[model samples]
Target: MTERTDRTVLLRGGNVYSPADPFATAMLVEGAHIAWVGSDGAAEAYAATADEVVDLNGALVTPAFVDAHAHATSAGLALTGLDLTGCPSLADALDRIAGAARTADGVLIGHGWDETGWPEGRPPTLAELDTAAGGAAAYLSRTDVHSALATTALRTLADGLAAQPGFDPDGPLSQDAHHAVRRAALAHLTAAQRRAAQQATLARAAELGIGALHECAGPAISSEEDLTELLALAAEGTGPEVFGYWGELGAVDTALRLGAVGAGGDLFADGALGSHTACLHAPYEDAGHTGAAYLTAAQIADHVAACTEAGLQAGFHAIGDAAVDAVVEGVRAAADRVGLPAVRALRHRVEHAEALDEESIAAFAELGLTASVQPAFDAAWGGPDGMYVQRLGAKRAAALNPYAALLRAGVPLAFGSDAPVTPLDPWGTVRAAAFHRTPEHRISVRAAFTAHTRGGWRALGRDADGVLVPGAVASYAVWAVEELVVQAPDSRVAGWSTDPRSGTPGLPDLTPGNPLPACLRTVVRGRTVHLA
Candidate 1:
């Protein structure tokens, strides 16, 4: 976490990957911007003038990743506290929680437990959580963060929980009930603990080659004080650049006051699919009830109008078809009120536009909306027989995360991990989109990579960044790879051969079984944020 002081550096013998010149072999970093890029010989000439010269030994260098949607404080907590992402069964999850609770002195907080893959096909009940916590207050969030199970002690601490929607006193809580408990549970962490957790998450992101993170904060997700503190921490230059988005309805003043990039990010139109709260047009295959909808079309249109008039970016968290319909209708109405050109100029975004019909896709393109999608959602719950199929049946499931369709319709695609729901694996996210379970829905590896990189920067209105070129931001990552191959849509093996004439740089072999490239270093503004 040391601040890099070297003002000038020459990176030689590396394959520089950029859209303009994908095959360049060297780059010169002067202060906070890329000064030059060309051959190794050209870099060598300026070596004497540089403050430092580092040989890359033929490593692949590209723009560092920018995660468009993330919950900074929650991600940090999950990193430092008990993580049950790998627990195979409900029994194992409870056992791990019990172990953590035995040693933990205060409120026990844990995350990332998914029962969809478990044999039980159900989460631990409230009684089970109580047994695990041994009377201590505990709140364990499901992998999707849409729902959570709380011990009786914790529920007692949460005010008016029984009166809230999605309340089940002895079972999992969703919607407002979940939000209430989450807020109470997060209150247990002291300021120091929260700061340490945030640092830990950002450090991990740097190691994974991430240069920036968009913190999706809200009244329901995290307090204004927490968001203020996180923004202050990022301003100190200790971690990646943090773009704050306060998702509260009619909170433009709050956003501007806190120096937020937007007033909407994870401003829920609905919940997530895994929690059976994604506001589907039809009832879930597994459950009788259709999902919940937090915002009506009128409400969405109103918020968009307010944000647009105030010159702020407006967005929503919409996953299911019904929610998508609502969002599209809202955007259409906003366009009517503010004019299509004005609405499009704002470049409003929709987080997790996972389930969309042809009509919705057209609406996104016509309105010039940015789709901030998470490919890992498809990787985790997609496929022929994955959790999505179990909940939605075969016909509806196959339509999940239609990346190819979205791209073809001209919707701007920005990729992210939605971390703590899925770990922040940028490479894995690219692979998942390329090798999507529905073959016709898959995109090329290069296209997927661009969405994660350049598309993400564009989402935050950083058009000049997320690309490696002269005069661009000098934020990039170096990786050591075993082999290089460009992935083709039809066949993985067919793309193994290098083709310089293809006008594309060789990317890491990211077939399902191939190992991802090991990140050697991550540089932000010509400063080393992580070095291995």
Candidate 2:
């Protein structure tokens, strides 16, 4: 028999895109790992001694994108279930419902709509949609996936949903409750359906060049059963790398037992700016309500205290300024009671940080909190006559989405697309940061990439990735790039993927100077998982 050798493969002539240096040339991969990455001279040694060689013809190379925040299983499920993501207006939403109503034997269910996009800011009543759908039980979630607007027939079925603490039939559902119905409806899917969902979701992530995902599991949204399903899949060596976060209030330690370390998962310390439950310092301009608060200040303190005491890194979902303050005070109290060592280990976080003034941004830096934000929010909704415009008024909306402010104030920023709420495209996210609505707040592409990678990895307190140094795990994306679309320093440059196929529909004009290129391949832990 001929000699069988496990040997090296050299990838040469690629424009390197590393955090510290971008001009590095050539890399050597051996035995499912990166062996050498340096100048072209290093390649000869590999060429003389290695097993295989491939010339890149000067394409760009970088660490694979990591979606720091997303719901993996659910995202997969949504693609196969009912995608109302492209439905434009209320009329269009109802028309789609009418169509899906005829095909579905069970509940006519879908997600992804925004009342703000319609001239009428409220969803049509159940009766109105019921008439159109012939009472097939329709449920279409708002664009953010925070709330669902349902028809009478669907409401009846949702009411009868015998889940635990959620899925109430009395009124429309938001957040936790919204998740319950979604889960129940998904339960109707067969094994074939689930597998298809997982495949599509993973394929999309691969196309986006995502090597890893921060799986933010929530109490009502993702369950122990869900974790089991994912872990089983991973054991079989399938799917993108998943960094799971179990959103259990009291069972985080158990989560650690299941091989998940903390990164994020917080509550509606109040709700969202769209739902007008941001727990404002003052009331909403039009609604005249001070938003909403989930826990008492003391209760909030207890949560922080509990997490710190448990030695877990904490992250809270705070959007409105008041919610931000609540978390800040609670974090301070937890730090004081628990001591310095406890405080430093916490790395407490706020999910949205959407609507904040100067003082709040500084407080985040001062408190050592991470702004676990989704920059895509600004790119999509920060435009004129958008959600922020009507909710906060033009004057207030003008300065909204303060990514630049947070960075300038020394606050550590981490990027995530509360997935299912938004598409988990890391390239899109970097573009959003590079081409922010307010140019003054625009961050460089490197900084934005860091937020998505290293900053996220650091927040999780792991030395895992976001870098391509020796001993670092081999995780990266190979680009068949036409251009880098995250930056635009001048008018002569074009940034972002204007191609509708590159990202979710309705993507804003948010690019810096470099145009987006296609992700040819994505690999995790030395294994190729995604290929264009």
Candidate 3:
């Protein structure tokens, strides 16, 4: 950990947005906490006692972001390795893969390939992947990270993947088959490579103004050794504070033993929508089949009850309506077993609550379940003619990612990027929520900003760290902004100007055409992690 010293630092000439004093223009940091916050003129008095002073040069300062859900090692690999996220078509993706294979030292692992916007509207086949790989093993995960395309060499490395439930020898693998192949692919990486990848991802997070991250690891996603290594790295205090969550069902002891904050996160209730595996009540429009459900209500109830009794947060990856229903039923049953108060006090969470109905929304609010969601998912695929409409048709697709409805129903919302699925862009995530495809579902800019900052802390059961105030932890970011405007809740695009004399803090102008602020510096616990 970065050693906290008894040094007083003064920051002046910047706009400080704090919950306690919304219009402060300067702040004094005494050790690892805020000592004073007030006007720039008044801050001059602190210079006599300050060991260091920084002039912000009219920048904007706010609380640093916390990503509630992420995959650190995989995201790092994508950052340092071949990335297929920008491939324009199937042919382009193949050419890139073949080129990567020709130069790779060993197995080639890549991520972020989405066929949704492709003109061909389809993914490359296993045969195509094999040809691209030449003689090497390769595994490329789709944008959702729920499915992957692997070469024959990689498949052969997994002993029984060919016979797994979701396996297709000639097509992309989902569920068990994908998990098996992924484990083999990950095993090929050396410990040095893993550490380098992890460091790269953390450096990127700091650049994007993220102060903390919740790493969702599991038996299927990553090994226990990987989680231990990552937690140890966090202890070094060189990067973001990483909170680990092991998503193994009924493994509360293992999670506690490994120093994980939760027993469940990305504990798959079903697969993803793009892969045609997300368990749904009704059949998909294009596939003509109801998606797969990995766990039943009874299984969910058992896990929830056990985790709650153990005083650990329990969560699941539920995207489809059927999976959401199963989660609600399980929570109800767990509440019955343990008292409702006990269950609610645990602050259990649900990841990607995408297909919720009225009842599920109410149930989540009543159970005090935090919705760890990704607004970037909606931004990428939630428009009228986006991939979601192609998958579920118009009506069913329109209901995805109802942020406004969830907020109105009293469900606590925390936002993240789900990196490697979507890039780690906090400003983009906030803009996506504010400018939701369905206008009725769009939230105010302030609400979206708060969700990405304060809500993320609450999701990890750290409610006291996301604000800038006296007695609060000194973690924040400085930004270069083009304009400052406080968006009005009643207007869609207008009514955004603010008067400085009113003493109300103004947020960055996030209207569609306005440029988002660029991060200049990120500080965590009085230590500088990133500086431009």
User: Clashes in model 3: which pairs?
Assistant: none
lDDT, each prediction: 0.89, 0.68, 0.89
Residue 216 lDDT in model 3?
92
lDDT by residue (325-419, candidate 2, tens digit) is 88778777777788756776667777788877888887677777878889888888786767777777777777777887888898888788887
In order of appearance, the predictions have TM-scores of 0.98, 0.87, 0.98
At residue 471, give the lDDT of candidate 2.
55
Clash pairs (backbone) in predicted model 1: none
Q: Is candidate 1 or candidate 2 better by lDDT?
A: 1
TM-score of 2: 0.87
Candidate 1 residue lDDT tens string, 226-309:
888888987776557888999998888999998999988989999998899999999999999889999999999998988889
Off by over 4 Å in 3: 1-4, 491-493, 501-503
**Ten contiguous residues minimizing lDDT sum, candidate 3:** 488-497
lDDT tens readout by residue for model 3, 24-53:
889998887888888899999998889889
